[model samples]
Target: MRRDELEGAVREALSHQVAVARPLSADPAGQAIRRAKRIRRRRTGAGLALAAVATVLVSTGMAQLGGDPGRQGKPVVVIGDPNPSGRPIPSATVTAAAPTSETPVDVLAGATLIGVSGGRLELPGVGPAERAHLLPSGGWLVVGAPTTAGRSLWVAQHDGLVQVLLAGAGSIVVAPDGRQVAWRDGTGLLVAGVVGTQLIGPVRTPVPGKAEPVRFIGDNVLVRLDPDGPGHTLWRPGVGELTAGSDRSTLNVYGALPDGRLVGQVSTDDPAKTCLAVLDPKRDLKPVLTGCGPELSPDGAGAVSGDGRWLLVNGWVGKTSGSLLVDLRRLGQDLTAVPAGPPVSGEVAWRTESEATYVDGAGKLVQVNVDQVRTGKVAEPVSVPGVRPGDRPVLVTG
Candidate 1:
């Protein structure tokens, strides 16, 4: 009975304490009321916060995988670039092949001109489409615009040589890779040191003191020295001055008359200084005619002289059908042609016109008849020790 009464007294005291917490006690009814209000305020704040979050998600168009309170009538996202019809997607890469084997390739990218007619190069990934050229011999030919090089000219020849410009007729051979190039300057001819962006020459035939045009020929740069004499010479970087090596070089000039006959502006009056002369780069004397002028040698025909002093022509032009024997000399009204000895080397590889290299196996150059290119053993044999150290000879044929 005592225990039960004590329990009842403890419960009554707790109830009394709770009632006084809001009122006068240190724990009063006033404090209890404040506590109750705080609890109610917390519950209300939490419910409002949840309601605000739900409202925000619905208004902002943000969504979760499952539909939420914010989900009204919005559609689900497909997650990729979508085609409503659901068509099959194809790949972007391309594979192409031409229908014909013979196609002229005029434009190219990332290409290298390995020879005169064709070249080798990497195909570009963009721009105009390019097709490879297949030769009759099953060899590959590439045609493209010139490319920048590591001190190399864009042109290469069939003989696997680079074209090097020079000053005179004598060619200046440049070493492979264009590190060194041979050149001539008047009497100064050398096959020695060269480098990137070096002075080729003063661009003068006679070093350009006169007002003459200077141009970069395949193997050399050309300029008229006296403009009157046979002095229009080519200039190269290491080479000082040189002329076209062939006997009919003057006629071979673009501005010259096709028949080796000059009717245009006369450069000089004195025949001694103005006459067509071929200078042996190693020798000091000048010869009458130096190279084979094809246009001037038409079936025993002769070309009129510019100065009206002589007739220039090939000595034995009518003898061979395709052979060219260049012999130019001064002829009086007698019409009797004077013949000179020792033939000049003129043929160059079209692929690499500037390199001073012959594709024949002959160590010593021999003159050929141009008429025989169709059949008469046209390809001459030339060999230059280490230059062509193969059993088969290097060829300088048509």
Candidate 2:
């Protein structure tokens, strides 16, 4: 009942309250600050969005998140990339979900530009890519959207580190070995060595007419000049000289075979038709083989297999817009054709010597097997999850 007794009772009550009470959050202010930082980071990276409509892969019943369907994976951010904005580079590998029963069928192919993880397209950190070339080092040199100068060129490493290589760049090509890259940046054609992800010892040479490097064959680069004509040249990087072939005026070279022979479309008697011709460069570029493949597309939308044994071209197959597969081994033999559902966009990519893929009009990725087509069968179309029709023309490397 004394004053000291009353004080002791009050202190005991205060101790009990402190022991039982809890803070609203472990660190409410710190949490709020972290949330604000994340939002700002997203806003800063908004300009890097390549698609008009952002896409996210939704895991089907095959893969479940916390017992429910969910987005595939988190965005991977790599720091200290060459980006001036200091934005984290989103690694393509991170967005891949584990394979599911609904996963698209994958075929053996050359290295793809973007990671097709789990049979789905893992959109890279680069802009809307118009074309991509695979680097021998397991990376990609991506050609992005058009700008005032030209298209933007970016290098995406295998690790998903994206760096803007050059802006306003014209047609670009990576050497067969992936050791070098050449591009026309309006001023002239430039060839640069590629080490890891960096450009080294860039050498420039002025080229006349509208020149675009097409392919790399041995030590020479095949260049096409004036898209409308049969003007082509072979140039050696850093040599500063363009060599015109004896057949340069007549042959519209598409690409070279593994044996260094040139494959191109030669004029036929009918104005509407052209022969899928092969020119032996060793023999003064003379046409050794001349026979039009089945319905070779007028625009020549096709590609040759690495071995040069097969040729695939886009054309009509019984009134259906499709791709024709020809056996170069037996040029006069029966031709194999596969219908292209929707309209075929972008060029076809050889997944392997016998398998190839292309994005159709519907933004769906479709694969074709040479063996299956030879048997009079067609491969099924695989829908690229999360991709809408408008997200095309999706650039998958050839």
Candidate 3:
């Protein structure tokens, strides 16, 4: 909708609404006549003005539903259950996401958003679109709508003299710590990420002569199942192929366990089989757990499995697809569940374990609690303006 039309809608809605006014009759006859006239006149004028304001708001979808501008610009997108365990989330005046940092940027729950900062990015395949939120980490996030293209794919703009990613971005990531990002682009994988503005370089994960899927381990590293070589090649940032697995076909590199130990599996379908094992370049592979996949924390301090425990087969529904969270305290265990929502491809945000938030099935903002995890009761969804999507939701974690 155009800006003017939004203004008109707001005006129309406010025009006929009643206002809190002092009792009209509690006055002397002469004064009452004057007061009544003044009230009517004021109401008429106010109504018209409000209508104008409403029109602006509705057309542009810029609804300042709460606090001032500063608070409205809270930069972070998280997908998970709402922490209904206790305190209320701070009221925010959310806005549509934009290319710049100051503007009120918004994205639909289903849509993914990528922002790049620090420098410019050059995509050989596509051109940059309109102004959207870009991070300062020298990485640009591209919102790839989940179609065949993949759900809301985020890519770092180009960087370096011969840039590979996040180069078109304006803002840079303040602190990436040591995180690696990857996604499937057809058969090969594009891996480029950061540790707070530090470019981790991108690779066209070698698939030997016959291409296969590529997986990210951590840092600026990736594991490619060398078609020619015997097993998986453990690739690291700037230091290619640190180690290779014994059996080339089975080794699938997931990533480094926070303890600096590598974890992975031999892709399989049998539930009775253990899928997880330690891939230390030093020692031989050892079985640790199964029925769960390896995942690391945002800070790179830990790893988790989506399912803390193996599913009991007798009554178990088909294995859950979203993910399994493993308990760090126990070696061969996993978390019950991490809340089964669609996998949003872009930046994901999560505050605590129990309280999680994500854009729901209908593209409305949903806050889920542990109760929702047990019963699958999603909380009332909230809407952020300018964000428009119906299939997937993205958490903007800047």
Best by lDDT: 2
lDDT scores for all predictions? 0.26, 0.54, 0.33
lDDT for 94 (candidate 2): 29
Compared with the true structure, the alpha-carbon lDDT of candidate 1 equals: 0.26
Candidate 3 lDDT tens digits, 51-93: 1221112221234312323221221111111111121211111
Error of 1 at 331 (Å): 14
lDDT of 3: 0.33
lDDT of 1 at 377: 40
Using lDDT as the yardstick, the better of models 1 and 3 is: 3
* Candidate 1: 10-residue stretch with minimal lDDT: 76-85
Models sorted by lDDT, best on top = 2, 3, 1
Model 2 worst lDDT run, 10 consecutive residues: 56-65
Which model scores highest in TM-score? 2
Error of 1 at 311 (Å): 20
Query: Model 3 segments beyond 4 Å from truth?
Result: 1-139, 143-207, 210-216, 224-232, 240-244, 247-256, 262-286, 289-328, 331-348, 353-386, 389-392
Q: Could you tell me the lDDT of residue 29 within candidate 3? A: 22
- Local lDDT at 243 for model 1: 48
**Model 1 CA lDDT for position 276:** 31
User: How many Å off is the CA of 155 in candidate 3?
Assistant: 7.3
